[model samples]
Target chain A: MSSQSFNRLTPYLFMAPAAIIMAIALFYPLLYMVFGSFRSWDPSQSLSETEFVGLANYIKLLGDEAFRESVSVTLTFAGTVVVAEMFIGVGLALMLDRNIRGMSLLRTLFILPMMIAPVVVGLVWRFMYHPTDGIFNRWLTQLGLPRVDWLGDHALMSVIIADIWQWTPFIFILSLAALQSLPRSALEAARIDGATGWQQIIHIKLPLMAPVLIVTCLLRLIDAFKVLEVILVMTEGGPGLSTEILALRISRTAQEFRELGEAAAMSNYLLLLLMVLTLGMFTFTRWQEARAQQLNKVKQEEG
Target chain B: MPKIRLDGLVKRYGAVEVLHNIDLTMEENEFTVLVGPSGCGKSTTLRMLAGLDIVSEGEIYMDDRPISRLEPKDRDLAMVFQDYALYPHMNVARNMSFALRLQKRPKEEIDLKVREVAKILGLTEYLNRKPGELSGGQRQRVAMGRALTRDAGTFLFDEPLSNLDAKLRGQMRAELALMRQRVQKNMVYVTHDQVEAMTLADRIVVMHGGYIQQQGTPEELFKRPVNKFVAGFLGSPPMNFMDVTLEETGEKFFARGDGFRIALPGRLADRARRVGQSELTMGIRPSDLNFDAAAPDSEAMDLRVSISEYIGAQSVLICKCGEATVTVEVKSETPIALGETLRFAVRPEGIQLFDKKTEDAL
Candidate 1:
């Protein structure tokens, strides 16, 4: 080969290892799962022995009451946890954005929850939700109040609360970063223009932080949808499938029900939902960059 | 219009004091300019007057009413910032009308006021555009429009034209001077440029190191600077200082220094004789030195021209008299050659004497 052809081939040679690993580790499983989702495959049978029954697994899930319940539970958990975390987390960031003494220590402590392993957080929260021996119930009993079942009757709510506690620091840190980066002069201008404290937040701070807040909320939503370890440790799809999200349902379908095709179909559904969210985040950043480019072009023309 | 007064206004950040007690009074509808180098506490005083910074001591009054404790909005003043802090998200009209909207003014009144101010600033065509979409000069116009819509009793400008290029700065300066005639308000402007202070101010306050060095009309400050600092700071080429000793020669007094001795004006001879200082510093402006080959050796200094900076119309020659360097400005058309020694006569009245140790005008 010519030296010019060799030079052009060097970049592709470097990318070959990553591409081969991606095909084997990522695309192989994805392709196998997607292709198997349209077949009638049993755990006892090899993949070559199974017959391809097009769309049968998906159609069966459409009518299955248990699968529908899992879908609804996953939606409720993801939606509720994301919204609740966003509000509480951004509010906490706003309240803590000042320069009081010991504020750096307090900020570090606030973000410590996000740094913990998900399994550890779940185990810690599970102990806290224990009916009789937990700190919360013990305090309730000492205060002359009836002990409420945390992980039994209100299982989904308990999982949602645990998710919020574990992930709110994610939103808080991002929101604080956005708030700190806002233009100081613009806020000063707003203050001199007669904006009160609340008015400044509403008119200046929130509007300026909107782009970061949107991306943060979407990232939290994506993480919330894939949550499994915390819910698995806390409830294990307990008390009649009340807190069984799609991840739990997929695991249970393949392990307990011995239906690999149905489990594969469920995973594809979750993937589709998350793809839309990821696309939304990418589009937002691209649009922001394009707008900035347009502004730069206009400025250049003026100059 | 109300007269503004700063009675012993001081600023301190924690234990570090930035401004000493500043006492200044501005008459109604007067244009008071604060001119100083960076970190001279001029901006601190202006921010204190705007209520952006708390006055650590003393009080500010407007028409005999104490206003130091009031909020910036309550002070009823408008300000144009150096960076032109227009809201990026809002259109020009909305940015200009923000204060009126906060006050809950009638929609028609707010619209009328925004349009009127926009028209005055030549921003009517671009009122619908956001600040991000406009050029810097356009954004600056929007900032001016926002301040103009307020109709406040006082206007404060913190070096508003310093962000522009030289041509734009000069253009905006003329527009500012034109606006000053139409807007009858008490204006306090802060800038490091003495040209802006001289051309725009009804009264100029020259400050240095947290102290007001001198305050007066442009001509008064230019002709009679209180000390050496003001003399060197206010001019383009700056006043030159040379070491000289006071010598009594017959009926006249001469400031004799390195290569030359020039007689002092008759009025200042007795004051020079009484001081009896063997060493003193003499100040002369570049424009005061004239090329006069016919002048007597006693009154003229033989200067060897080293470099001549030709700046159209006039050329400033960098010349030396023995070890002392002096500058002379003459018509550019004059025949001049580098490395040629020429005798330049110094006018007696142009000589300013200062104490060598104190640097105070004598």
Candidate 2:
């Protein structure tokens, strides 16, 4: 090969190892799952022994009330947790975005929950929601209030509160970073222009922080859809699939029900939802960048 | 218009004090310019008067009323910042009308005010564009327009034109002077540029190291600077200083230094004699030194020209006299050559003297 041709091929040669690894580590399992999603497979038999059952799993899930219930539960879990976490997290960030003694230490404490292992968080919250021996119920009993079934009748809501407790910190740290990086002089000018504290947040802070907050909320939403360990440990899809998100349902479909095809189909549905959110984030960022570039071009032309 | 007064105002950040007891009184409808070098507490004093900073020791009074405790909004004043602190998200009209909108003025009234200010600033065409869409000069105009729409009694500018290029700064300075004539309000502008202070000030307050060095009209500060620092600060190319001693040369008092001896201006001889200090430093402005080839030996100093900087109509020549380097501003057409010795007659009226030990004017 000529030197020019070799130079052109150098980049591809460098990328070849990563591409091959991706094919085996990522695309291979993805293709296997997609192919297996169309076959009626059993744990007792090899993949070659499985019979072709094209569209059977999807058709079965269409009218299955349990599958429909799990979908609704997943939507409720992701939606409620995301919306509530965003509000409370952003509100806390705005409130605490000031210099005080020990403020840095306090901010670190606020983000502690997001660093804990999800399984450990699940176990911790599960013990905290215990009926008779839990700290909350024990304290409530001492306060002369009656004991309530926190993880029984309110299993879905209980799991949601736990997830929020463990995940709001993620949104809190991101929102705080966005708030701190905002142009300070604009906010100071707002104050001099007679903006009240609340007015400054509404008019200056929130609008400038909207782009970052949107991306953070979308990222959290994508994560929220596939949440499993916390709810699985707390209720294990109990109380008639009240807290059973799609990820937990897929796990049970393969391990307990021995329906690998249905599990693969459910996983694909979750992946599709997350893909939409990721695409939305990418589009928003691209639009922002394009607008900034256009503004720069106009300024240069004017000059 | 309200008369503003800073009565014994001071500022301190923890243990370090940035502004000493500053007492200044601005008359109604007077334009006061504070000129000083960087870190000279001029901006801090302005911020204090604007209610953006807390007065550490004293209060600010307006028309004999203590208004230091009020919020900036309650103080009923307007300010233009150095960086043209326009809101990036808002267009020109919105940015200019923000204060009016905050006051909940009538929609028609806010529109009228914004339109009027924009028209005056020649920014009507760009009112719908964001600050990022405008040039730096246009952004500065919007900042000015924002301040003008307030209809306040007092206006404070903190180095409002310092961010622009040299040519644009000169243009804006002229525009600001024209605007000052039209607006009959108490104005206090801060700048470190001596030219800005000289051309635009009704009265100039020169500050140094948290202390007020001198405060007077431009001519007073230029002709009779109270000390050596003010003399060097207010002039371009700065005033030249040379170590000299006062000699009782028979009948005439002469400031005799190495390579030169000049008779003191007749009017200052008695004053210099009364000072009774032999050790003194002589000051001469660059503009006051004129080319005098036939000057008598006693009244002229021989300066060796080292470099000539051509700046349009005039050129500045850096020359050495004895051990001191002096800058001389001359017309570019003046016949001058490098490495040649020249004689410049010192104009007596432009000579100043300072005590060697204290640096105070004699």
Candidate 3:
């Protein structure tokens, strides 16, 4: 090749290793799953022995009531946890954003839950929710209140409580970072303009932090949708699918039911859902940028 | 219009006391400027009056009603910040109308007020634009527009023009002067720039080391500063300080130092003799020194010229008078060569003397 062509190819040559690793580590497995999703195969069978089913597994999942129930459970789980986390986290951030002694230590302690292993968090919470021996129930019994079922009749709530306990700190730290980075003078201006504390939060703090909160929400939602290990360790998708999320069910389908093709198809569905959510986040940020640019254009035109 | 008074106000952050007892009074609709160098507590005083900072001691009275404990909103004052803190999320009109909307004012009234203020500030064309989309000068106007729309009894400006570039600051200064005439409300502005204070203030308060050095009309502060700090602070090219000895020769009083000795005016001589301090600090404004080759030795001081900074009409000459340094503002076209020793006559009335130990006016 000519020197000019060689120079043009240099950037691509540098990217080749990363691109090849991605193809092997990421794209190849994804392609295998997509292709396997079209087939009906047992785990024991070789790939050549599997039969091409042509959307049979996907169609089966659509009609299956159990799969449909898990799908709805996943959506409700992701939506509720994200909404709850956003409110509590952002609220806590607004409260803790100040200069008191030991504030840095307190802030560090606040985000410690998110730093722990999810499985360990699940196990710790499982022990805490034990009907007779748990601290919560023991306190209830001592207080003359009836002992509440945590992992039994309220299995879904128990697992969700565990999930929120582990994840709320994730949202809190991000929201706090967002809150702290906001323009201080604008908030001061809000005060001078007669905005009370509550008004300052609503009008100045939240609106300024919307972009970060949106991105944070989408990130937590994406993670919540694919959650398995914590729910697996805490409730084990017990009490007949009450807390059986799509990811747990997908694991059961492949491992217990011996339906590898069906599991792949289910995983594809989860990926598709998360893809839509990420695209939504991307589009929202792009819209904000475009609006800002348009306003800038107006000013530039006048100049 | 209500008169404002800061009575024995003090501010202390933990063990470090920043402002001493500050007592000040402004007549109704008066424009008061607090001017000083950084860390002089001028901005702190303004913030206290704005209700942004809690008063560490004493009371701030408005029309004889103490307002120290009130929230900023309840204090009924508008402020223009140095950074021009317009809300980045809101458009110019929304930012300007924030105070009115917070009060649950009628939408029509808020819109009308915002529009009127925007037009006055030349921000009408940019009302729908976000602050992030506008240039620095435009954002400054939005901040001013926000304060104007409040129509509060008092306006507090904390170095509002300092953020702008030199050319824009000058233009905004002129606009502020024009606005001051039309707006009848009381205003307390703070800045480190003496020029802004001189031009904008109806009354200028010079501060140093957390104490009020002097407060008076700009002309009064310029002509008769009470101490070395005030005399040195309130001018473009600051006043030159010369360490001179007050010696009585026959019946005449002469301030003799380094290069030359010049006769003191009769009024200053009488005052200097009463306190009876031999060592004195003499102050001469840069503009007071005039080039005169044939001037008498007792009336003029000779300066060895070094550097001439040609700034338009006046060239500020950095010259040495004996061992003490001095700056002389003279016409740029003056035929004076570098390294040449020249005589510049000191006007009798322009001489100001202070006690060397106390730095107080003699």
Candidate 4:
């Protein structure tokens, strides 16, 4: 090749390794799962031995009671955890976003749960949520209250509580960073404009922070859908199909029932849901950007 | 409607004090400007007036009623910030109406007030535009309109025009001066630009090094600065200082430097005799020097022109009088060239004499 063509190909040459690695490590499994979703397969059968069952696995899941229950359960779990975590985390961030001695130490302590491994967080919460010997029940008994069945009757709530405990700090730190980075003079001007503390937050701080908060919420929503470890450790899809979210359901379908094709179909459904959510976030941000650009263009013409 | 007063006001951050024993009073319906260079405590003093900073030692009084402990809003004042702190999310109308909304004013009244102020600021066309969508000058006007819409008795400006480009700043400054005439509210403005102080201030308080160096009308500060700092600070291109020694040539007092000597005017000549200071610094503004080759040596300083800066209409010639550099503003049409020696007669009334030891006016 000529030197000019060689120069143009240099960037692609550098990217070739990462592209190959991604195809092997990521896209290969994805393609394999997608292909397997159209066949009747078992753990003992090879791909050659498996019979063609195009759309059967997906058709079966459409009417499956257990799969429907898991979808509902997954939505509820993800929605509740995200909503509760957002409220508590943003509240804590707003309350603590000020200069005070020991604030840095307090912030470090607050984000400690996020730093711990998710499995460790799961195990710790599982132990704490034990029926009678758990610290929570023990404390309730000491406080003259009846001990509640944490992981038995209230398995979904207990699982959600554990997940929220591990992840709220993620939102808290991001929200705090967003809050601290806001234009301080705007807040001061609000004060001069006769804004009370509450007024300042409502009128200036929250509106300015909405963009960051929306992105944070979307990120958390994505992670919440793929959440498997903490729930698996805490409830193991528990006491019924109550807390059997899509991830746990897929794992159980493949590992326990040995329905590899059905499990692949279920995994695709979950992936489809997450993809929609990711696309929704993208659309929302793009719309906002387009509106901003339009406004600027109009203003420029006027100027 | 209230007269504002700062009695021995002080500001301290931790163990270090910034403003010490500041005493000032702004009369009712007067425009008081606090002008100084950076780190000169002009902004700090204004912040204290706006209740944005703690009064470390003294109390602020309005209408003889103490307002040191009051919130900024309770002081019945509005402020324009240096950065034009408009709400990014709110449109110009909403930003201007924020204070009125907080007051729970009727919707009709709020709309009318916003419209009135917008019309005044020529922002009627841009009321629905958010700050981010507006240009810098528009955003600054929205900030000013936000303050104006409040109709507060006292309006405080903290370097509000400093963030604008030079041309825009001049435009806004003239607008502010026009506003000053239309509205008689007590206005306290802080700026490092002496031109702003001179043009807009009814009374100017010149500060330096966290202290009030001098306070008076703009002309009073310009014509009769109490100290060297004020004299050097209040003029454009600054006053030229040449160190000279006082020598008595018979009955006339002559200021004699390395390579030039000029007889002192009557006022300074009599004052120099009383000061009895052998060493002095003579200050003469570039505007006060006129080219007059035929003038007597005693009344003129012969300078060798080095570089002439052409600025249209008039040009400033950088000239040398021995070791000291002197600037003389001459008409652009004046026949002057580099490498030529010229005599510029000093205006008798324009010579400012200062004591070398104290830097105080003689």
Better of 1 and 3 by DockQ: 3
Where model 4 places Cα greater than 4 Å from the true spot, the runs are: A291-303
The ten-residue window of minimal lDDT in model 4 chain B covers: B257-266
Relative to the unseen true structure, what is the C-alpha lDDT of residue A226 in candidate 4, on a scale of 0 to 100?
94
Error of 4 at B112 (Å): 1.0
TM-score of 3: 0.96
- Please compute and give the TM-score of the first chain of candidate 4 against the native first chain: 0.96
The residue pairs found clashing in candidate 2 are none
Q: What is the C-alpha lDDT of each candidate?
A: 0.90, 0.91, 0.92, 0.92
Off by over 4 Å in 2: none
Candidate 2 chain A weakest lDDT stretch, 10 residues: A184-193
List, residue by residue over A1-303, the lDDT tens digit for candidate 2: 899999999999999999999999999999889888898988887878898999998889878899899999999999999999999999999989998989999999999998998889889988999999998899999999998788989888889999899989888999999999998767767777888888889888998899999999999999999898888888899887888889989999999999998888888888888899999999999999999998998889876
Of models 2 and 4, which has the larger DockQ?
2
What's the distance in Å from true for residue B215, model 1?
1.8
DockQ, Cα level, model 1: 0.60
Please write out the lDDT profile of model 3 over residues A76-179, one tens digit for every residue.
Answer: 88888888888888889989999999999998898898889989988898889998999899999999999999999998888887788778889999999998
- Which 10 consecutive residues of model 1 chain B have the lowest summed lDDT? B267-276
Which stretches of model 1 miss by more than 4 angstroms?
B273-276
lDDT of 3: 0.92
Q: What is the interface RMSD of each candidate, in Å?
A: 1.1, 1.4, 2.2, 2.0
